[model samples]
Target: MSIQAKSERALCEITRSIRTRLQDVYGPASADSLFHAVERLIQRKRRTLSVSAGPRFSEKDALLITYGDTFLSPDRSPLSTLHTFLQEEAGSLFSFLHLLPFYPWTSDDGFAVTDFRQVNPSLGTWQDIQALGKEWKLVFDGVVNHVSSDSLYMKAYQHGDPDAEDFFIALPPETDTRSVLRTRTLPLLHEYQTTQGPKWLWTTFGPDQIDLNFKNPKVFLEIIDVLLFYVEQGCRMIRLDAIPYLWKELGTSCAHLPQTHQLIKLFRDILDWVSPDILLLAEINAPWPDNVAYLGDGGDEAQLIYNFTLSPLILHALVCEDASNLTQWASRLPPLPAGTTLLNITASHDGIGIRPTEGVLPEEARRCLTELAVRHQGAVSGKKNSYGTVCSYELNVSYFDALNDPAVQEPQEVQVRRFMLAQLITFAFRGMPGVYIQSLIGSRNNLAGVRKTGRARTINRRQFDLTEIQQELGTPGHLRQSVLSEYRRLLSLRRKEKAFHPDAPQAVLDLSPSVFALKRGGLPGGEEILALHNVTNRTVRVDLSRYLSGERYQDRLTGVSYARTDLCTMDLTPYQCAWLKKETLISA
Candidate 1:
């Protein structure tokens, strides 16, 4: 076939697939119109937007996740201050910057978006965001599942505007929504006074946030336009927040519905046609199987999915001084396709979620985790399950505090080592690593902030003034400076090794219960790195010859060499990590 003919055929197939998904959600009668409207939007976007096919994902790619206002300055906007901090302190350590919901929001920090198209004036303007994009790829939050109740669309709905009549989901008070999954303890339906009457609206998150009605084709088109706008504004990636609850069905779980998957496939198709470089990241905080479902066959849905189970599993291993569960879980992970990979993150804007550890960790283990949080002056959040029981949902503590108890009068060096070991394990995994801003600086739990805000998540979301942070980082032997220095060194080393590629083969080795060991890269003569992490508070010896082949191996972290009898066994100190490479590969 001619090249033009092949292109036409591909376009036809995409249109057909989109139309089929539309028909599945809406009726067949409305499918044609919706398809035409979507096609027009895509074409217009292609004509107006100049999306550069930027560099693809690679082993060197790492994301720095933070809020736009995490760094404050008296001289400029928070966004600009963040840019300055990155340029001066972070340098080229991170390739992507995930700005968590910088839009105007009524509540929930920035999740309850009041305006979709504009940035929060308190942070900065579009130019400021674009400036940051020039230095590092930007990841914007697609808070499309719901909007603030005070948003214009909700206001229009309340005023009975025809254009916004079907923008939100509202039903009778006694609607049969018991099957709907709940992520929070708040009521699923909240009574709202609308122009029609006092109706109960679905609020998956809370009262201030109202769910959008995807049953209406207009709502779908509106979100599509907003996503395209994000790409046009220089967002290389979009994090779909609360995506599992996008499409609702009365008698079903209303989570991860068939329609939700179809809609995500449609989104992937549209993005593939218009801006092929832009990636979609699904933020599903569910069990392992359900979380991996968002990566639908590895190519048709999200390009990246959060490895929500990793954080909790790492915590469990380190706290219990055993790596049995962590090794077993890593060995069982299904192989990912070429274009999709997991985003390994140790911490984020929210707390350490327990929902992802459903089958991986036992109930008693989870109880111990929550108990540890309370002992460390942290808190826990709960959610309501289908059984009408309130269960612990997540542990609200900083990653540093979770690993090192502040009450224990240990040396700062010991605490830093233990904390960095947890982070190093995430970096050595077979996926791209995402570093939270607070983790880079070894921040502790902010119980005062939690008390003031009356929100458990506030324990880790403390903002820092730019000048104060700079001073602290400049001081010698400071905890923040020590942590940041070690983090930078490890990240730099990771970028130089090809074995850390997201698609590289990983073999989880069970050498000892106190050590978490994994080998990256193919077997035989292929380039590889043997990563060993000690998850205990005492010295442990591991037999390297049991799993490794070559006699001589060199430690990348320290320029120490092991050969002959040394290769048979090696000792790792408390919270020590070693990245071993074959001596021949190092010489080459």
Candidate 2:
């Protein structure tokens, strides 16, 4: 069937659902009015669907996570500078580029979006964005949960404009909302003294940001419209930022509400019709169970969910040199639905999230991470727990610094290897690996940036001069060059193997406490992979013959060939990882 035809049919069902939600939130009379308006919107415009084909996610599919201004230069615009860097130094290193929120912002480093439709003037023009789109698949952040209070839409609502009545979440002081989840320790309400009256807006992340009310059907439609606008701007992936906080009821804990799930399903249906290949990435940094829930029914919700647990747990395993906790948590993971997969990354624009480690990591293990961060001159940020006590929420440090403690004064080579070991663990997982720009370039703690911004996360969100970074990378045997070269090599090799597919059936192997072993089976053919990593500093021997079926075998990364008899005993050096293929597949 034609995309437009399928969308027309789906539009009928969506309109009905919206009408029901409207009635539930705003009553029958108002619902009828809203439904009429939504009908008009559907008739006037539908999301455009292009007929051209795009690349699907596969073993070759790796993502690069970076802020739009990550590669900055005095001589050129940030976007243009970034484009040139990718073309010259890092052509095709990543299959996809996840451009973090680049909208005009008042605070929170672009999360507090002042304008959704317009590109940040400082970042460059929309044409630059389109130019990059010609090469890489782009993932745009849909910061629909909140907007900057300085936004025109917020100003209109603050000035008592009737058209903006349903724009934001404002409530009476007497309303009880103690049950709501607290993503930050700031006050729940941010007061705004407007011309008409003194109003309070719900601010989930912080004061400069005001949450939108999904209960107000108009606000929901506004989000949908903005999403369509993103599609038009060449986004192949739409990441729903903090979507769990979209729906709130006074008496309930407003995290992952049923209404939120319904809204996501509606989005999936709409996006499938509008752009079938555009992947919806859900950024839920909650417990492991809650995180995977976004991949509902395998395909109805998000196609990709941030593997939040992997970051903290992998750090724990590497720092503690014990994979027991990581193995335990991963072993208990429920089977994911067929059409959906997980997106794993060692680092991001934000700090390493700790909430995802609630049950998986022991208190001592958690403390170990924080102490190591402090020793490395890294800041540990926290949020208020339910008991009103501040607890560590995240570790703010560059992935390089996070890997090794400064107190020990480890050699730079050791730190680089340790960091790459973590990346190896990330690639070994049955998920698409996302390489953070800082980790790839071997960046250290950006203390100057933090001092300038007075934000802990700034320690990792350091902007670099593309030319200088490239020079350092070009210098032979330099730490940056070594790290960048190894990273490129790993990615280049990882892309060609079939056993590293994101949807492969993976089983955690209980080999040894010091080693993290995973068996990835069910590739393009009968080929399988036995991934082994020695997280500890000492060499660990594992009898791989038990896992090997036939004679022809090779390690995917090193290309070291061996017969099944020789594979019976294998020793992995300190922080070494090997992707041992069962048999050489001529086709792959």
lDDT, candidate 1, 550-577, per-residue tens:
8788889887988847857888999999
Model 2 steric clash pairs = none
Please give the lDDT score for candidate 2.
Answer: 0.83
lDDT of 2 by residue, 10-43 (tens): 7677566666766665678887887676556544
TM-score of each: 0.97, 0.94
Candidate 1 regions off by >4 Å? 1-10, 51-55, 523-526
Q: Model 2, which residues run further than 4 Å from truth?
A: 1-43, 51-56, 523-526, 586-588
RMSD of each: 1.7, 2.5
TM-score of 2: 0.94
